[model samples]
Target: MSKSQQHDHSPLHIFLIFLRMGLTSFGGPIAHLAYFRAEFVDGRKWLSERSYADLMALCQFLPGPASSQVGIALGLSRGGYAGALAAWAGFTLPSALVLILFARGLSSLGESVSAGALQGLKVVAVAVVAQAVWSMARTLCPDAPRITLMLLTTAGALLLPGMWTQIGLIAIAGVIGARLLTPVQAINHAPLNVPITRRTGVLWLMLFFTLLVGLPILTHLLPWTTLALVDAFYRAGSLVFGGGHVVLPLLQAEVVPTGWVDNQVFVAGYGAAQAMPGPLFTFAAFLGASLQGHPSGFIGGLICLLAIFAPAFLLVFGALPFWSAVQGNRRMQAALSGINACVAGLLLAALYQPVWTSAIFGLKDVALALLAFTALMYWKLSPWLVVVASAFIGWLVL
Candidate 1:
């Protein structure tokens, strides 16, 4: 490993770096991943491209906000427990704070302002995710079989349209890739300098499962609204796959149907979240603060925020050690290849349905999307720059 890889990053430094990203990583989860790649992989050389891709595959396999999980994992690799916490705080706090304020002031903000900016944000999402699908496809699905797998996964996700289908598709793709795809060999084969030991990882894994199994029962016995919030958000976090966008329906089902939040308010918050520069899971914070009774405000936001993200942190720590253990296993590597390809497909599917369908209503929207894409791909402007331009241009035009 180079000295750069071995150098210890201060927790404060990690927090600051991620805070900058949190403030500027606009679009959505897919776009956030692209920004992470640019900052961590390309700019900082914090990890190899292959390792970054492998870590993303792991995040995709497990449930939670994929981009947020990736940020947490990166922090862990860089600065241990404090780094992970700092990363989550820095990347999440900005959006959570904004959304909570939005929740508190929903009556004043109104729909018109949010609607136009949201349209702009959605257009930016289309461009950012398009770039991601293209880049990831080249990296993860270069071969015919992998390309076929990508296409099939995209089709399945579009045709079926649910979290379960997305999970099953990824699982099936893993199985198929293990059997059929070329075994992936690590490029540099460097062990990630993750801070936790195998024993600690095992303990974390046990705690994760314990909570997964016990939280619901605890909620049932307690019968408190806060506990209910915990149970609802925890279940949504544990089950969602693909990325932040997919979390929408799951969260909507959990909170909206329960009368915890109005459907219109839930939807408006979702739109605003797309425009913000952080993890989509932070929407939980908005919902929590927006709740009709008890624990509303900062306290409620804190509860929902932690509940929703706990599983992702647990799974990352638990899985990292085992990931190191399985590095040499050809079948495991092959499965990851398949999983990565399918992840590309998932992004592609998301681009079409919610992103493309919602954002592209006419030639004007189409023109804006193309302009944003050009700014990113050809002009090679910073994504934040592109996002800002798209938002302002959209505000004026739309």
Candidate 2:
């Protein structure tokens, strides 16, 4: 049966399905991807495995929340624009609301919350990123040349820390990949038959680029506080590659040095974010709510949330019309090969700097991280359970 013939085409059905996933989905992006594959592909048969994998690859190459973009793409194929909105709202709102409320309550707590627990959460992040790096490296850079590219990318990222450096490396890797990486034999996939048209795709891509260029200038000229906030968050979202975890470094560069939110609060929110179900981009909500500027409340949270996600939506819509055609192209395959390898390397760099450096201080920290990693890798425990356990252990020992 075609996607059009599937039952439960209502936007509400889409919303409810995603909402359940949002509430229960744990681990990080990788885990979320697993849950999504099981639910949509294996259980519901909403998409064939080949089509799902193709969509996943497309979203992976785009600069935004990868899993979230996949979810949006799935919704669009299922129920069109309204379905996409419903899917996003359901998957995102749970975590966003929690973080917003947490920020509000955190302000009242002052210094009373357990620092050890927070540190534990950061340690959990270390384990989580480590797991992601291992998983992605195995899948994305299995070949010797790809492995070499991954190492080079990691070294360059560590040596030169900036958004431009990240972008430059990805671009260079793509060029090299086009020259070097062998293309995979393309597998034919069932067409999703989404409603996006070439014209709409062009418009979405144009708007994406326009906002990328125009938002900064508008903020600079107008100097409106809200505009600036949107600009900052939007840029953070626009430039993020790999996955949501990478947004950490980009966002830190944007907000932390500027003192928009204190380092302690930022770390706390990030640690808490690991425990949340949906996209790690929802961390923007916490930052907005915790901000000391004009948009520092519910409205601020909403604005920042919307701004950060807008780029992903635009890019997905823009690319959807052409994705199937490009998926089978050798040139596009080579580019993806390079880009995916670099993404693994980028995740490695991220794992070391902010995640490992900040979280691991002593033997105790190492032990806790190892324990969490074991739970995730060996025991095959739920990430949420590992997170809660790690926090408890941290509070007790750290």
Best by lDDT: 1
Clash number by candidate, in order: 0, 0
lDDT (10s digit) by residue, model 1, range 248-308: 8888888888888999999888877766779988999999998988888889989999999
TM-score: model 2 vs. ground truth: 0.69
Q: Assess the local accuracy of residue 96 in candidate 2 as a C-alpha lDDT between 0 and 100.
A: 93
All candidates: TM-score: 0.86, 0.69
Looking at model 1, residue 47 earns an lDDT score of: 85
**lDDT of candidate model 1 versus the reference:** 0.83
Report RMSD (Å) for each prediction in the order shown. 3.3, 5.6
